[model samples]
Target: MDILVTGILLGGTYALIAMGLNLQYGVARIMNLANGEILVAGGYFAFIAYTATQLSPILTIFLVAPLAFALNSLIYRVMLQPLVNRAKSRGQLESDSILATFGLSFIGVGLMLSFFGGDYFSYSFMAVPVEVLGNTYGANRVLSFVMAVLICGALYLWLNRSRAGLSIRAIGTTPASARLVGIDVKALSAFTFALGGAVTAVGGALISTYLTLDASTGVVFTLKALIIVIMGGVGDVRGTIVAALLLGILETLVATLLDPGLTLAAAYVMFLGILLFRPQGLFGKKPT
Candidate 1:
């Protein structure tokens, strides 16, 4: 029962992470390798804020979100947006993004190592535990789960029900057509990327509270994000949530049943199996 509940909670968290990736890769049509770094950056911001200001963790979002948004905008303006200006498919542009993003990841890791050092760390200041269905869980974990769900829900509403959100999707699917209809593609892309970064910042703050983290956390998180996005499908929101949950549960079960190292390997193998059978992704639209 604990396993089941924990897995469900973890899956919800991964969904938050994946949804942030979706905004960039799915809606903005940018393959952002920096997605994970953005998450960690947010985490670090919260960490520093907690240490310096003694502010409540929940209040940290106000500062973290804006900083993350600005940093994301800078990254796009410098690295990604240039590749986007050239006429090319996602494959071509993503190739460049991969290299740039990986480089960014490496640099970020190096900087963190230089400044923060190599140490396994966690913050437990704002902890609160709760009981559900005769099961007990961390208050921080519950808060994290609730925050993830609320942010994702709000984002879905914005994208699906709001005019701006509809415009974001329309522009990504066919920018040429959207432009012909007078949508501001450049502004929209920046806005979407910033919004995605803000969401990731929230995820990052949750990470600081829930997991032991260091400079290398971003690298692993990025790979995990990749698995979720690929399994979920490129540019599919619903697919991402389902995929993150499935992977989250599967990973949890595997860790329980087998050696820890083998768990990731097994998950990758499962991912490959799914890709072989349904390359368009489970919830992805069939290619034309």
Candidate 2:
């Protein structure tokens, strides 16, 4: 029971982390390697706000989200749009984006290192213990989980119920067809990319309340988000949520029953199994 509750809380946050990447890669068709950096940046914003202003990290989302969105939009316009225009094929664009964002990741790391130095940062917020199902857990973790649930739920509704969301889904499903139907694929892709960055930043703000993070820690999150996105299938929101929960449970079980150090290895093993057997993801339909 303890493991289940803990893992669910952890997976809820992971869902937020991966959802942003899914939006970027699934709809914008840009494989952003710097995604984790954006998340880390969001954490930094929360850390700064909490330390300087004594503001709650949860409330920092309003400030972080828009800032991330603007910066990400600028990055897309200045750095990625040219590649999108010049690429000869989807494969080429993806390859170019990988290289471009890989460089961007390094730049982000360097900037963070220069400003913040290489030290771990954490803050206490709602740090009291909360009992659930005969197990005690940190209140911050529970709060973060609740916030994640609300944000994800709202996002799901927007995607499924709104006209703009339908267009975004159409673009993700078939960009060419969406274009044929008069959707401005380029403009919408840029919006999706920026929105993805904002969502990822919000995830970071929530996570900073519970996790120790440093300038270089972003890469770890980047890889984790990548794994979750792939395992869930690109653009599949439901799959991402389910896969994140499964991963959380698996990691919790492994850490509790085996060695804590083996949790990451366990994740890799699962990822490998998914790639080998269900390359299209657990919920994703096989490509025709």
Candidate 3:
């Protein structure tokens, strides 16, 4: 029972992170290896804000989103845009993005280590324990879960209902067709990346309140997000959330029933099983 509750809370954070990746990699078809680094940057932004101003961390969370958006937009303009413009094929562009973003991740880690050092940082939430179904849990975890749901739900609505959202989806489906139809593919793509960054940053800020963070800690999150995104199928936003929660439950259950040290390995095992049985992903449609 305890594990289930805990896993649900953890799942909320994972969903946010994975959802952002789904928008960038799954929808845009851009393998952003630095997605995790961007998440870390968001956390660091909140951390810096809290430290410098001694303000409420919750307020700082709002601030991190725009900072992340701007940062990713800058990255898109400088590194990704030129490559995207010149690429001969989608396959080649995706390959290049993977390598380029992978290098960018390392750069992010190096810069963070230099400035923040290799130390773990966390914030005190001063939250009290709340009882749910006779089980006690931290209030902060509950808050994180609620926030994740609300934010993701709002995003889901925007994507399904808004005109700009339709444009984003159209580009993802067939960029050339979208372009011919008058959608500014490049501009919308950049906006999608920026939006992805903002979403990830919000997740990061929530995560900092939940875990001890270091410059290198975000790689684990990166892997987890990738796994969930793959499990949910590329570009399937709702599926990503569902998969993240399920993975979290499975990981927590395994850790509780077996050895805690096996949790990470268990997640990989699940990933492998999914790939072996459903290469198109759990929610992905079969390719013709």
Top candidate by lDDT: 2
Q: Note the residue pairs that clash in candidate 1.
A: 128-139, 129-139
- How close to the true structure is residue 195 of candidate 1, measured as C-alpha lDDT? 79
Whole-model alpha-carbon lDDT for candidate 1: 0.79
The TM-score ranking, best first, is 2, 3, 1
- What tens digits encode model 1's per-residue C-alpha lDDT throughout 22-101? 78887677767767777877788788888888876678977887888888888878877888888377688778777877
Better of 1 and 2 by lDDT: 2
Candidates' C-alpha lDDT: 0.79, 0.94, 0.86
What is the Å distance of residue 70 in model 2 from its true position? 0.6
Native RMSD of candidate 2 (Å): 0.9
**What would the per-residue lDDT of candidate 2 be over residues 23-89, giving only the tens digit for each residue?**
9999999999999999999999999999999999888999999999999999999999999999999
- Model 3, range 70-168, lDDT digits (tens) per residue? 998999899999889889999899899989998999999999999999998887774689998899988878887888999899999999999988888
Could you tell me how far off, in angstroms, the CA of residue 110 lies in candidate 2 after the best superposition? 0.7
Off by over 4 Å in 1: 87-89, 126-128
Candidate with maximal TM-score? 2
Clashes of 3: 0
Record all residue pairs in model 3 with backbone atoms less than 3 Å apart, i.e. clashing: none
